[model samples]
Target: MKVYGLTGGIGSGKSTASRMFRELGAEVLDADVIAREVVEPGTPGLAAVAERFPGVLGPDGRLDRTRLGARIFGDPAERAALNGLLHPRIRERFLEQAQALADAGVTRLLYDVPLLIESGLHETMAGVVLVWVPRDVQRERLMHRDGLDAAAAEARLAAQLPLDAKRAHAHWVVDNSGGLESTRAQVRDVWNQLRARD
Candidate 1:
């Protein structure tokens, strides 16, 4: 199986491109989805988190994601500490599910990681497809989607690796400036090229 990574910043349309890949018959493993699942109601990951960040739970005993996010986002050391506790577990879960997909003979898989470049996972892919859009567009989209004013949006963007830096390492680059269907067409072209390399 050929495992490729798809990555971009918060509002670069990476998920939209990934959905296009899925429609093209690729097995898509989303890091954010797995991250949430690992810490859900009954998991050991949840237990560990609750142990570290006490009272971060609802009355029904589920992890309060909003509460935890606010706490961690404000404090960098706290964020790193939580990551230390959670990353290993999330990695293990991702591996198990990815292996299952490989075993099922899904040769071309797209692992959509928002922080792939920041986390240095690009080195782990067979190849990488980076989604890119102009910085102004990115900021606007982020502001609209996140309800962040311009300054706050810029701060959020500053947290991750810059789009240009990620673009430098891509095996393929999908520019999302034009339109949704245009982006989808680019993903199709890239998928054909990636699978053909096998």
Candidate 2:
């Protein structure tokens, strides 16, 4: 099985690309989904989080991601602390899932991770496919999607490496600045390329 990293900036339509890949019969492990699972209501992950950052849990005893995000958004030390608490657990789950997929004879696995480059997980993949969008487009899309003001959007983007810089690390770049049909065509082309590798 060949595992590839599928990544992009926050508003670069990475999730959309992941859905297209899933539709095309590729197995995808979404980090964000796994992240949520590791911290679900009754889990130790959630307990550790609630211990470290009190009041982050909602009335339902679920991790209030919005509150936690707001707490750590621009604070490096707080963010690092949170990452330290969750990353190891998340990595363990990722390994378990990847091994299960491999055991099941799955090929062409795509790890849909938004912070693939930042976390340096791309080094473990056969290659990386970046969903690209110009910064202006990315900012506009982010503002509209998240209902964030320009400053907030810019702050979020600043936390990650610019999409343009990440291009140097990508084996393939899927430009997502265009419309859905165009993106689908590019995604299909990339799928063909991945299939060809086999």
Candidate 3:
């Protein structure tokens, strides 16, 4: 199986592109989904998080994402601490899933991670496909999608490496700033290219 890294900034339509890729028959391992699973109720991941950040779990014994987000936002140390606690568990789950998929004879696998480039995981993939959008479009889409004001949106965008900078690391760039059909067309093209490479 050939594994590719799919990444984009928040609101750059990365999830949309991931769905399209999945629809096209590529196995996708989403880091965000694995991250949530690792911390589910009764898991050691959840227990560690609850111990480190008291009061962040809900009455249902689930992680209160909003509370945790608020706690980590604007606090680099807290964010790093959270990453330290969750990343290893998430990676373990991701590798397990990949092995299962490979055992099932899956060919093209896309590791859909928002931080593939930032975390330096792109080096492990066959190639990286970045969903790209101009900075202004990214900021506007983020504000609209997340119901954030311009300032808040910009602050969130500023937290990550800029989309333009990430383009340098990509083997394929799917521009998703235009209409749905246009995005789909680009995704199809990328998919074909991936298959050809395999």
lDDT of each: 0.88, 0.94, 0.94
Which of the predicted structures, 1 or 2, would earn the higher TM-score when compared with the native? 2
- Which portions of model 3 miss their true places by more than 4 Å? none
The segments of candidate 2 whose C-alpha lies over 4 angstroms from its true place after superposition are none
Q: For candidate 3, which ten residues in a row score worst on lDDT? A: 189-198
Model 2: residue 174 alpha-carbon error in angstroms: 0.3
> Evaluated with TM-score, which candidate comes out highest?
3
Model 1 C-alpha lDDT per residue in residues 1-198, reported as the tens digit of each score: 777889998899988898888888888999889999988899999999999998899899898988898888858898888988888987898889988988987777888888887777889899889999988999999999989999999988887888999988898999999988899889899988987886
Superposed by TM-score, candidate 3 places the C-alpha of residue 143 at a distance from the truth, in angstroms, of 1.2
Alpha-carbon RMSD of each model:
1.2, 0.9, 0.8
Better of 1 and 3 by TM-score: 3
Task: Give TM-scores for every candidate, taking all chains together and pairing residue i with residue i.
Answer: 0.95, 0.97, 0.98
| Cα lDDT tens digits for candidate 3, 32-71 | 9999999999999999999999999998989999999999
lDDT by residue (1-198, candidate 2, tens digit) is 788999999999999999998899889999999999999989999999999999999999999999999999899999999999999999899889999999998877899988899899999999999999999999999999999999999999999999999999999999999999999999999999998997
